[model samples]
Target: MSRIQQRVAEAKAAGKKLLVAYIVNGDPQPEVTLPTMHEMVAKGVDVIELGVPFSDPMAEGPVIQKGHERALVHHTSLKGTLELVKQFRQTNDKTPIVLMGYANPVERFGYQAFATAAADVGVDGLLTVDLPPEEVVILKDALDAVGLDNIFLLAPTTTVARAQKIAEHASGFLYYVSLKGVTGAGHLDVEDVKSKLAAFGQLTDLPVCVGFGIKDPTTAKAVAQLADGVVVGSVLVEKMGSLEGQPAAAIATAVGEIIGGMRAAIDSL
Candidate 1:
């Protein structure tokens, strides 16, 4: 199995849903990002979805938009993000890292070159938010050649035909947008999300992870019962933004508390 599949499967075997944490690379400051990542791993984050800061992150709301702005001030490029992953892998190699961003950067970075750099830096997956599966053939082939998983997102508005198409293209896991709006825009209705996941489950065996509105321990635990993974984004980014000038340990502590609480809640389920 791939590193992502192994880690996610291990969570399943343990009777607990995986906790996937998202952080914008170089947010607040570049130096603190890696330490904060390690802290999340220590506090029970099963997988890391590192956001590659982009100029136009249409899928993000205010909280994540602010994060991208902060990271971009330091000029965090696609190559720089890959360098951060390489630094991260020097000590820790087990936790999977998924690069979540837009397609413009990858296109500029050259598809083949980006895939090779990503694999060399220990990146396990890619989720280009704006890339539809119909246009994903070349990029998907490049990623497949390098043994990296290409993740796709499905939304509540997606029709059955579209869902099947996405499922066919998705590799690591299928990220199901639990709401109709952008990330951090709506209140997550657990029942509605459950029904959507149930329908997708019948279409493919790919792990369907719910995201976009999961903000707290209560919601995380509730969603954990229905999906293979739970992804928390804006809330954590907000916390990182709040700790801008503070020490690295402070950022770690603040983020760790939120993830640790959700971890406890999911395990108890």
Candidate 2:
């Protein structure tokens, strides 16, 4: 089974909800994003979703947009992030790494080559923001050939038919966008997220991970009650403003401490 599936299954068996964390690759540069990715897994993160920095991020909010800006200033690219993952797998291969970003860059890199490189680097899955279910076939088939999961996102505004289609094609898990706006917007209505989770549950058996706008332990816990998994990004990246030396983004640092506390909150429920 995929690490993602195994994680969700174990969470289900243990009566716990999975905690998925997202971070932009090369935020402080490849040197930093690499170690930070490892730290996240070592500290109790169930899965890692690394964002491939893009020029025009339609789905990203100001925070992640800022991340892309910083990462770009360091001159990081898809090749760099995958290389980081290649270096990452030298010691650890069990932790799931899903590259989340836009489709233009992937296509620009050649779909087949991208798949082969991701598999070669030990990447477990992908979540391309602008790649819809229909357009996914070109890359999805290539990914499947390499044994990589093509994870997709479903939004609150998505139609039931669209949701089913996305779920049907989804491999690792279904990333359910919690709200209508960009990531780190504001005030996520738990009831709205719960309603969306119910909708995804009706469509597929894939582990549903709720992301975007999850701010703290209380919010994460509330969403976990309905979601099979929870993904937080903006906050963790925010924790590293104006710092040096790995920026404390390692999963074992302050970010991990917060996630540890959030996990506690989920456990408390």
Candidate 3:
């Protein structure tokens, strides 16, 4: 099993839900990224979805869009993100690191080369936001060869047939976009999410992780009760942005507290 699968399996065996945290690499500043990542894991993040800065992050909301812009100012390329992962691996070898970004950078990096380098740097998965299941074969083949999970997104409007098709290509876990819009867009309707997850349960046994519209411990707990995991991004990124110009330790502490609160809330279940 890949690190992601193993981590999820471990959480399942222990009767715990996964808490996947997302943050842009080189955001605010490149130096702060590494410390924040370590603090996040220490505070109870099960998997880390590190965002690679892209010029046009279509799926991200204003907060994360600003985060990408901030990272871009520091010239955080795909290779730079990989180097951060390599640095992260030195101290932490267990937590799964999944690179979340667009397809253009990956295409420019070459599928085989990117997959090889990612695996070498301890990356566990890839979530290309705009890459659909139909166009993911070549990339999936490369990732599969190196034992990296190719994660996909399933939206609330996805048809049953389309969802089944996505499940066929997804591994490690399925990221269920809780909101119909971009990341951090709408209010989460718990009942709506519950019903949708129930529909997904019939199609695949892979872990379904709910993201978007989950901004606090309350929402995380609500989603945790319904799905295998909860992915939190915008709120964290917003928090990081608010703490910009502060010391790295301050940023890490403030962000870690948010993760800690969610962890406590989820464990309370």
Error of 3 at 81 (Å): 0.6
Candidate 3 — which residues are off by over 4 angstroms?
none
Residue 44, candidate 1: C-alpha displacement in angstroms: 0.4
Q: Compare the candidates by lDDT and give the number of the best one.
A: 3
Q: Write the per-residue lDDT of candidate 2 for residues 1-269, one digit (tens) a residue.
A: 87777777888899887888888887755567766767777667888899899999898888888888878888888998899888888988778889999999999999999999999988999899888888888998999899899998888899888898788899888988889899998878998888767767988878888999998999998898888878989987776434434544453376667667777887888
As for lDDT, the candidate ahead, 1 or 2, is 1
lDDT for predicted candidate 2 compared with the true structure: 0.83
Candidate 1's displacement at residue 229, Å, is 1.3
Model 1 lDDT per residue over 1-269, tens place: 88899997898788889899999999988987899899999999988999999999998999999999999999998999999999999999999999999999999999999999999999999999988998888899999999999999999999888899899988989899999888888798999998888888899988888899989999998998999989999999999999998998889889999999989988889
Across residues 203-237, which tens digit of lDDT does each residue of candidate 3 receive?
Answer: 99899999999988999999999999999999999
If ranked by TM-score, best first, what sequence of candidates would result? 3, 1, 2
Name the candidate, 1 or 2, with the larger TM-score value: 1
Q: How well does candidate 3 match the true structure, expressed as C-alpha RMSD?
A: 0.7
Per-model TM-score on C-alpha atoms = 0.98, 0.94, 0.99
Q: Backbone clashes per model, in order?
A: 0, 2, 0
